[model samples]
Target: MADIAGRAGVSLATVDRVINRRKGVKERTRQQVLEAALALGFLGADEMARFRDRREANIVFLLPAGTNPYLRDLGDHLRQRVALREEGSPKVRCFFIEGFNAPALAEAIRRNADWADGIAFFAIDHPAVREAVAEVAANGVRLVTVVSDLGHSGCDAYVGHENRSVGRTAGLLIGRFIAERQGAVALVAGSRHYRAHSEREAGFLSIQEEMFPHLRLVGMREGHDDSGQNYRHTIALLDQNPDLRGIYNVGGSSGGVARALAERGRSDVAFIGHGLTKDTRNALVEGVMDAVFHTDPETLIDRAIGAICQPERQVLPMKLEIVFRENLP
Candidate 1:
C-alpha cells in the first residue's frame, strides 16, 4: 500500500481508499494507484494474470543498443514476434537503450512502467537500475531481468542463463584445451556494469585458480560489447603477451577476438566466448574459437512472456549450452 502510494505520487490514505474500494478517490488517482500497484509486483500472481487477460497486455523489452550480435538477435526475435502477434495476444515491443548507462536504463524502466503491463530488460549491476527495479516492483509491475541481472531487486522473474557457471565452463574449456596452460589467458568483457560478465569473470577466475593454477589470467579489457573495441583490446593483449595461451571473453564480440587471433596467427591460443551467433558459429567451425556458451533467444523470450502473463510459475535459471568446434550443431 505504501509502495503504491509512493510510486503513484499519492498519499497512503489515497492508496488505502483506492485499494479498499472506497469511493472518495478520483478515478484518475485511483487508476494511478492501481498502476503503481501492478508495476511493483504488489499484485498477487492470480491478479497479475487476470490483469493481463482483462486488457491488451503490453510487454516492453529494453535491450542494450550495443554492437553485441546476441543482444541484436534477441531484439530481432522480439520484433519478429511483435510483427506476427495475433489478436488478443500480448503486444510485444522492444527498445534499444545505451548499453552502459544505468541512469538512462533506470529512466526507461520508470517511463515504461507508467503504461507497460510487463517489462523485460537487459539488467546491469548499477544502483540506479536496481532502484528503478525496486520502484517498479513496489508499483507491482512484473519485471523480468534479461541477460544480466539487477541482483536481489524485487523483479518478478529473470530470463537468462546462470552466468557464473557459463564463465566457469569457458574457463574449464580454455584451460583444458590449452594443454600446456603455462602462459597467461586473456580475459575480456563487454562491461562490468553487466553482472553477468563480472560473475562470469569471477567463476572463470575461481576455476583458473582451482584447476589451472599454472596459467595467469590477465587483462580484463572492457570492450563494451563493441567488436571494434574488442578487436583493439585483443590486438593489444597479443602485442603485450607473446605467450598468450588462451582467450576467454565473458561478454560478446567473439568475432573481434577471433579476428585478432587470426591476424596474429595465434590459432594455438584456445579461444572461448559466449553466444552462438552466425560469426561465432563460423569461428567455431573454422577452429578460430575453441568453444562458446549459448542460450537460444526464443527460450529467453518465451520465459519472459510466461513470467509476464503467468508470473506465478516457478522461474528457473536457464542453462547455457556450450558449443565446441567439434560439435558445431
Candidate 2:
C-alpha cells in the first residue's frame, strides 16, 4: 500500500480509501489507484478486506434467478452468517447474478477477478462459462462449484452432493413410490443445462429401469428452473396423462409441481422430489407429496466460506438428506 501510494503520487489515506472502496475517493482517483494496484499485483479492497488489516473478502455467488428455493435458502443462510459475523467471517460481500446468459456471467466473473479472493457459482457447462472459471483460477481466486457443478473445470472444491449419487437416490425413491401404481411416471427437471439435474435424472432412470420395470418413465419435461413454467408444464402433462402415477422433480422448482398437482385435484399421485423448503414440508405433511431429497444449504455455504478462507483444510463432504413428513426438520 505504501508502494502503491508512492507510485500513484497519492497520499496514504487516499490510497487506502480507493483500495478499500470506502466513500469519498473520486471515481477517477479510484480507477487510477485500482489500475496501479492491479499493475503491481497488489490486492483490491475486496481481497484486502478479508484481512484484520480490515481486509474485505468479496465472494461472488452466481446462480439462476427467480424464486429458486435452494438458492434462496443458500442466500438466506449465507447472509444470516454474514450478519452474525460470529464465526469465521471474512469481510464478506456477495453478488447474486442470473445463472443463464453465459457471456454475461462470464464477464461478471472476469470483472471481479481482481477484486474477489474466491468465487462460488452454480456453473453452467458452456465453453464461455468454463473459460471464465478458468480465468478466475488463473487469477488465483479460490473457486468452488455449488449446487449444480462444473466437474471438469478445475474448481478448488465442490460444495454439493455427489450429484450422480443423489440423482440415483432420487430415482430409486421415486421408482419405489410408484412401483405398485399403474401408468408411466413423468419427470420434471429444472434444466438439462445443469449437471446436477441431469445426473439426478440419470440415477432416477437407472434405478427405475432396474427395480420398477412395470412403471415406465414416460419422458422428461424441461422447466428451465422457472416456477411458472414448472407449474404450467406440470399441469399440461397431468392433463395429458391422466394415468400418470408419479412425478419426480429434480431441482429447485418443486413447489410449482406441488401447485400443479393441487390445482388438478390429483394430489393422490405419488409426487416426490427434492429440497425441503417450507413448501415441500407442508406438502409432505398434508400427504400431497411423498418425500424430498433434502440438502442443508446453510451448511453447504458455511463449508464453502470455510474452503475459501482456508483452502488447505478439507471441508467435509455434503450429505443427501431424505425428508419425510415425520422428519421435516
Candidate 3:
C-alpha cells in the first residue's frame, strides 16, 4: 500500500480508499492507484475479485442512422462484441442518431451524461459537439471519439484508422490505375464537417498533385453520405465533364455512384471508394468499383472498450485494409 501510494503520487489513505472501493476518491486518482497496484503485482485474489465484482460501467455508443451500410454493420459489430464478452465487463448501449445532425448528437451526449460512465460516438466536427464533449469530460465521464474525430475536443481517446493514410493509399491506387487514362477525375465526399473526410480529401489531392499530374481533378461534391444525393452528384459530374475517366469517393454512398455509372453505361470509368460492405463488394465483383478501403469494426470496438475500462493505457490507431474483387471475403 505504501509503495502503490508513492508510485501513484497519492497518500496512503487515498490508496486505501481506492483499493477498498470506499467513497470520496476521485475517478482519476482511483485509476492511478489501480494501475500502480497492478504494475506492482500487489493485488491478491480477494482484492481482484472485489474489483471484478464492482458494478458494471454503463457505456453508451452513438452512431449515425441511414443507408450507410458501413456504419450499420459497425454498430452491429460493436453490439455483438459487447454481448459475447466475459462477465464483469462494462455494459454497452448503442444509439443511432438521425442524419448526422450536430445538435442531435450533442443532445444524446447531454442526455446520457448523468448515467453513463463512458460515452463513445462517431463525432461530427462541429462547435456544438465539441462543447458537448468538453462538458461531459469536465463532469467526470470518459469520452472517446470513434471513426471521425473531433479535433482537440478534450476527449479521453480516439479509436479509428489514420484517415490521411487511408486517403493516400486510395490516391496511390487511383493514380496508378489511371496513369494511361487521358481525362479528369471527380471527388465525392459525405461532408467537410467531418475532419476525417477533409483530411482524406487533403491527402488525396496532395498525392494527385504530387504524382498524378497528368490526370486532372475536375471537381468535388458533397453527397452527404446519402445514395440519392450521391446519385445526383454523379449524374451532374458525368453530364458536365464528358472526359471524366475516374472517381474517388472519400465517403459513403459508393453504391449510388455505381448505380449512376451503370445507368449511363460508364462501366469503363475507374471507381475507387471506401468501406468494404455488401454494396461495395457487389460493386467490385460487378466491375463497378475498382477497390475499397476498410478497417475492422471488431478491432475498433475492442480497443475502445479497453480505453474506457483501462484508462491508463494508450489507444493506438487502427490499420487500414484495402480490398479488391480478388480478395473479397
Identify the superior model by lDDT, candidate 1 or candidate 3: 3
lDDT, candidates in the order shown: 0.84, 0.76, 0.85
User: Residues 1-329, candidate 1, lDDT per residue (tens digit)?
Assistant: 88788899998988886666543343456678778988898877677555434455688899999889998988889889988999889988899999899999999999998777789998978889988888886765678988888778888788888878888888888887887648899889988889999999999999999998999879599999989999999999999999899988889988999988888788999888888999899888887888888888998899899888786689889977878877777
TM-score of each: 0.84, 0.80, 0.85
Task: Provide the clash count, candidate 2.
Answer: 7
Q: What is the lDDT of residue 66 in candidate 1?
A: 80
The numbered model that scores best in lDDT is 3
Clashing pairs in 2: 48-55, 49-55, 49-56, 50-55, 50-56, 167-200, 171-204
Worst 10 residues of 1 by lDDT: 19-28
Worst 10 residues of 2 by lDDT: 48-57
lDDT per residue for candidate 3 within 260-305, as digits (tens), equals 9989999878899888888888999999899998877778777887
> What's the distance in Å from true for residue 112, model 3?
1.4
Against the true structure, candidate 3 reaches a TM-score of 0.85
- Residue 147, model 3: lDDT of 84
Angstrom error at residue 106, model 1: 0.7
Could you tell which candidate, 1 or 2, scores higher by lDDT? 1
Give model 2's TM-score versus the native structure.
0.80
Record all residue pairs in model 3 with backbone atoms less than 3 Å apart, i.e. clashing.
none
